[model samples]
Target: MKVQRHKCMNERCSYDQQERIPFATGSCSYTHRLARYVIDLLKAMGLKDVSGLMDVSWDTIKDIHVRYLERHYSPPSLEGVDCIGIDEFAVKKGHVYKTIVVDLRTGRILYVGNGKGADSLDGFWKMVRKKGVKIKYVATGCMERTGCK
Candidate 1:
């Protein structure tokens, strides 16, 4: 897509601007339709495969996926949450750990944190306190080890 560049012919004030493409976002090379197609392909394929098929870089495919996620899934609200389940799972060969907090009633994930144990939930606890969520029941994978109630 070629965008026409407009230049001011005035010698005293020389200003130049390019016409914006209707199908693409500001400064992005890919069109909106292409991005949507890539996202659809990603649902069935991995990042590397999608990038190869689309003839785009792996990082570009990742960036498109991340932007799509950010636009669609903004974090769920913690309001009216009484029962919550907390669990820690290994991400890679039991080395990298990730903590996930979920609302028992709706089964919606509230927070995700890096690492495990009590320290992983510090930010979640702060958010719960700040939001004034009165959590009544708590279910955890390791209650004794994590000191969770």
Candidate 2:
């Protein structure tokens, strides 16, 4: 749709602005309804399939999905958190790995860090110290590697 551009008549304060569309965001090519539909389709389809079905680019569909996730799923609260589980797994075939910290009771992911070792958990430990989180029981996947009994 073509939005009509409005120009201010005042000589001193001349400004041009395009009319805002109620169903769409600023400068975005897709409407809110279309974005919602794409998100719904994503639940039952993959990214490439959704892109092919909607005739939109893969990157655009991924961006829309990411934006929706960011808007709805913020970081989980750390309050009243006691027991947590730490585990690291390779993101791909190579040495690249990621460490994840999850609340044992609620099964909610608390932190994700790059790499897989003691250093990867430094940030989480710092946060726990700052927040005074009294972690009583600790569980890890690599007991032998960490020398934990």
RMSD of each: 4.7, 5.2
lDDT of 1 by residue, 19-72 (tens): 888888777768899899999999999999999987899988888899899989
lDDT of 2 by residue, 54-141 (tens): 8999998998899899988977668989888888888779579898899999999999988877778778878888888887877998
Clashing pairs in 1: none
lDDT of each: 0.88, 0.85
TM-score of each: 0.58, 0.55
Judging by lDDT against the true structure, name the best candidate.
1
Backbone clash pairs for candidate 2 read none
